[model samples]
Target: MPGPPKSDATHKPPFETEELRQKLAEFLDMEVEVPGSKAKKKVGNFQFGIYAFFDYDKEPIYVGQTNEQIRTRIRRHLTNQRTDAVAMNVLDPFEVYQIEVWPLPELEGKDSKDAAAKKILNALEYQIFVKLREESSFKAVLNEKEPGKPDFEVEIPHSYKGIVVSDEVFAIRNHPDVRIARRASTLSRLAQIISERQVQRGLRNTLLTQATRLRALTERRLRGLEEKAKKQGAEPEE
Candidate 1:
């Protein structure tokens, strides 16, 4: 398999800001070396404060974030007695590897700390929550629709369409005769209602467009008349 494309450009971030520094600080505080390993001493300089995605049995799962050491966090996750034991079951100790570090903030105040951490985490490019199965994935389900129309109607739950006929208008139109006329009416009657409403809307939109044009023309004419009056040295009556 081909690896990712190689670019000639040297990789470097444009500039690091104060917020980034704070997140980096938190990141540096939480890394651990594999026990009884000769490389443990060498790994001490590694920082690990960010959230990471670890795969288990080749399936992408488990997301964790911590200001605490990564070794400690992984240990807790692997243990059965901890509060998040169910989450731990999915991860194999040998299979666990730090894929990426999601940065977090180091702040003094509680609210500020929480907000900063969230901000930095959100700034991460990947959808960490879904990749970790922390949130449900929004799959595009196939929808059935009437022929000749678009199949999918995007529905935003609880969004307001608009108020139909004003309360006063409905109240007056709700009278027996009006209701009877509308009820017994066939498709033609329904068509009449729709057509009339559409015609009214069209008329309104047309009038608005014409009014705008008229206003522009009127202003231009006024300016021309003013210029003419100025040349004749006559008082132009308003």
Candidate 2:
């Protein structure tokens, strides 16, 4: 008997996802100057770091720290969806347009379990948390748990920032109407999760932040659309 005929067309991944993957790879592979070092190092290779995710508007949405390689941790959050935040519906990978990382080059070889290393990491994370909080218009990030308070503040290292989405992807995802819809959907699901279970204050805080974000996006979108309609109405009929 003859075997079944093969399909003529080649199967391919979604264009947006493939483009995003390529751009994210490029961003991660970029090399940056390390403080006090003549040599430059890949940002992804850093074993200890603090990373933040920003939306299309350059608003910081989430922040995290990792003893694992920055590449591994970020890929987990964005590509794999294995992180607690993703699983809990507190974060939507689709919302992340840019990433900024502060690599701790001095902690490169230190053991993850070492107390000194932990202290430095904690201090660095706390510093980043405070910095992003100040920079954020909402005065909050999506992190469910705040970093441990450190007695002393550490000077943040030079940060490498880059957009992870391709132009094609950004053109679709950056539209005000599309963003408002996505934001509202995410906020609804998050609110549902909170209502269905007993949650912590931090989770409730996240819900509030999501609500605020959704409202702001919706208002902005409405304003722009109304302005366009008014301008069209004012024009003389051709």
Candidate 3:
């Protein structure tokens, strides 16, 4: 018998890459950030899977996995609303503005996914946790008790790596009105503490120094943004 004929169409994958990405984004409940906009609309309920939070600087701050809805777990980390973050003080919702998630629908079956799928997710989470820990870019993993070793050998695909959300999502949070509100809150707390003499004499200077540094950073960032916005309105260079 002759060798099989060249199949131009069948040789390619069943689905195109962009189509796959769109499908994956939909499945994972991922949102694309719209530049210079505060308005947001929910995509879909996040499925059970691994998730990670990034800071304003796009550095991994936390790594976690959930057998339940990923959305529920993530909501507890929001700044204004939190479950245990406020009580623990390890993670500040204000600092956690970006999020990337990997939704595993395969794990949702009442019978549970096969052992291999579970193993891959577990090992993937472990690998990501190790990467974040080694980088030490953010404060720390807030809830992970330990970096559990991967129970199974699995390689995280380049395309399937954990998401690092863009910083644009923070535009609304950093708006001038929000900044003033935050300043007022900070002032109120400082006034109460100082009035009650809660700060020790030895620690007062240290507290003041940190406060001043934080204020300076905030001002610098605001000025930088303002200048950039202004430059955007200027004539283009020849």
Q: Tell me, by TM-score, which candidate is best.
A: 2
Q: Estimate, for each residue in 1-238, the C-alpha lDDT of model 3 and write its tens digit.
A: 9766677536555333333334434434645332234643232253446777764556565677765566566655552355543333334455554566665544455333556666767887887777775775332354425446875655543223333223343455556556445544544555455677654442344234335434655776677777777789954332
lDDT of 2 by residue, 135-173 (tens): 999998888888889998788888899899888898999
Off by over 4 Å in 2: 1-11, 234-238
**Candidate 2 clashing pairs, residues 3+ apart or interchain:** none
Model 3 misplacement above 4 A: 1-46, 79-82, 110-120, 136-140, 157-238
List the candidates' TM-scores in order: 0.26, 0.91, 0.46
Ranking by TM-score: 2, 3, 1
Give the Å error, residue 92, model 2.
Answer: 0.9
Higher-ranked by TM-score: 2 or 3: 2
Number of the predicted model whose lDDT against the real structure is largest: 2
User: Mind giving the per-residue lDDT tens digits that candidate 1 earns over 1-238?
Assistant: 9666565353743222232233333433434343334333211132233343332112223445454443355345433326232221222222222334433223212342465444443333234434343331221100111112222332111100111133344455445344333323322333344455544343343233323333444565577778989999997758
Clash counts for the predictions, in order: 1, 0, 0
**163: Cα error in model 1, Å:** 60
